[model samples]
Target: MKSNRFHKQLCAFLVTAACMPQAHADAKKMWVQGSWVNIRQSADMNAKVIDHLSTNTPVFLIAQKDKSCEISWGISGHGYIPCKFLADQVLVFADVATENSSPEKAKNYSPTRAFWIAPSMRGLFNAGKYFQENLLKPEQLNLENGSVQDRPEPQRPPKLIRYSVPEFEAMKEMMNKGVIAPVVAFAPLFSCEQMQEAKRRQVGSSKDEFTRSSNDWSAPDAEKYPYSYIYAHDCLVPEIPKLSLPKIKVSYFKDVQKVLPGNTQIEEISAKFGIVERGSVTGSPRWALDYDTYRYTGAWDIGSYTLTLDKPVYEHVIGRTGLVAVYRWLPGIDEEPFGPSASCEEGLRNQRNGKELLSGYPKVKDALLWFQSATPLSFRTAKINSRAYLAPARSLKEGEEQRGIKKVVVYEVDLDGDGIADFVQWDMWGEPEISGPSPLLTLRQIFININGVWHPFERDSYGECT
Candidate 1:
């Protein structure tokens, strides 16, 4: 009876929050919420200390052992940490009121518990004041169950930017009548093995599309098609030329040879690439910050040139870097000497680091001017592929079927030398479904080349085959 009772207690302890088989199978990402959590060699609290983990560090929960969790610490080896210190969602912290706290004591000031809030509520409320005001209000948080107990409902329906009733009905009628035909588009399809490879590479799903699990996908016919290929589909894609980026104007800087005589200044230098009527290359160049910063875009006559002013708008911050500029050879080849003798990567770094400055470089923003031009390349131009995808724009939010009908055009380039495209450029045009005005959805993202391995930068939208 004693042995059976001990066994029951052991099962009870093991069946705690850490013993989630589904989470272990999925390798669910969890964050360390404690100030300074310790990783131990064993599940015991007094076990040999393996390492110290800082708050917000990500760990993969492997399994549960007593009150501790076996976690994979991101290439740092496996160890056990207290399950209480791990949170399924990210925890944001605020400054707490303290009395007579010294710097030494403040270093170890870890808040006991943190409350989860909707992402939309972030930055809108002062945490301390908001919590104090709403503590006894309706919508009390049920911390025990990680849910809200008496959540209050909104007074009215959320205001959405939507089409008029007539327009929406007309679109539906046309779609039903087959007047608006679904065009042939393509989506990346991955096999089970390919999906595993994608997970190993840390490739994420597209923002507009969710990747289905490998088990749900049928076995790919190897004889008929390659293991991973772009699958074609018929979808409704609207042709909105008004939403597209305006074509860049072609204006050379004084016929290439004569252009250099008077055009030694940065403004004259930038003039090589002609003016790009209105829309920026990165869609909306207005970067929203506490203070104002400006970005201007122009054309690449011979190559692309971007000049940035890191000056403050509201109040200038002392010692900030200024007049940062980037100039690239349009020819897409490294052999040419009219630009530089160093390797492409090294030369680009030099330009960014402000090491290489032209004779006409200015001292202040007042004298700055820009034009667009570039040196003709001896090599052939990089190939650009424009493919249509079924991912909808930000406009379609209410109807799932209508969302799948919307289409986007993706421009791809092979920047990583992997023969497969590692860079994607695309533009989404529409009013957002949400309340606030939508910014231009232009994206020009590339896989960062680190020691020859291309890694995609963190982004909301992504395009890669599993």
Candidate 2:
């Protein structure tokens, strides 16, 4: 009898295990397309070829292996043709339903707009020239005895400088202001003593010791002071374009399980997450895509809950499972302006309340959900120390009541079945106190993943004020 019961339990466990859903497949089909630069009469020919392809010409992506892909040109004459191009051309895939079909026409695409080029490509081309010019040839020099011989000095190593955000911002401002004059004009007037001082300070070394210890100090006028104005001028300027922003690729994911409040706290959760208000109803959680991170937040009767993650969790809702990084979002308590003067003090205050709320509920592990970057520049997690002080909320006037959030959470997700997340969504919230039409929530920063590395999207120019 005991053996029969054990066998029955074992059968039940096996059945349950078999019924469990599997994780979503990561494999995805992507398209690769690019403009033809120079097409010749033959592969090896140097002859001129007519008919340059336009920048936004649509090309069908047949297959992608590693970084290269087989593409079919959409041109009337050209059929299936394979071309060697970088992986950056693989934009987000078509919607999942259309994945199996032929490539669709690209809309609102303009080729004249600048596209990002990978740094690896830049290094390949620039470093090749640098090697030939600086390393391959032997240096010809004249000795004090009037003898000319080929003498190549050892190559100077590259220097790396670490800079803070403020310092970088200052340097950019200076460069834009053109405070520094041309090296040709300024180098002649620059004192070697000042340069030596700067170098000594930078490296934490003294000049007297450096000069006495150096072996190349006895060379001819030019070679002895090889670190002169002409050399200094060349070293000061950088070869790459400083204005270019970091390149990042965005991926979207979809069909993830949505976490709704339990039956008890539905009303509070609705108000907290900006679902229902005085008379309006904000829609359910929508898809969103930012270059950097995925965020979701809503309030509950017990307290407000926020779930911030590095990647979207749409797959989990759709019965798929994968690892995801989680963070607690803590909103600020104080109302601040949307400018440079905004600080993290208000967010810190809100975090204190969040901590209390968390202590009350043992299940809550992640901390409060605070707006890191908003119109008013409320809180910057990167700028503030993790151990900074969190203030307590103060009492409000009799007439003043709590104002609900009027912002939306932006997300980047793969709405299409393609392995990459390309879709972006803005979840809007209504302002209960305001009488006018509902305002669309704006996203201040976007997270992007380019070539498996993550980066934050930065604004190129400041927006004009109305």
Prediction-by-prediction clash tally: 16, 36
What is candidate 2's lDDT per residue for 1-466, written digit by digit as tens? Answer: 3333222222211235432222224412222233233323333334444222222233444444443333333212122223453233433212111112334533422121101111111111222222223322243111111222223433222221112232112222222221211111111222234434444544446535543322233211222211121222111101111212222344331111112111112222222232221111122221121222222111101012121222111101110111121223232121111112212231111121222221121232332222111011111121111111111234779986433323434444332333443222222233333243443232222222333333321111112121
Q: Tell me each candidate's RMSD, in Å, in order.
A: 24.7, 29.6
Candidates in order have lDDT scores of 0.32, 0.24
Residue-wise C-alpha lDDT for candidate 1, range 45-122, written one tens digit per residue: 899986655445567888887789988754334788999989897544322212124675345333222111110011
Model 1 global lDDT (CA atoms, 0 to 1): 0.32
Instruction: Give the number of the best model, judged by TM-score.
Output: 1
| Candidate 2: worst-modelled 10 consecutive residues by lDDT | 113-122
After superposition on all CA atoms, how large is the RMSD of candidate 1?
A: 24.7
**Alpha-carbon shift of residue 41 in model 2 (angstroms):** 6.8
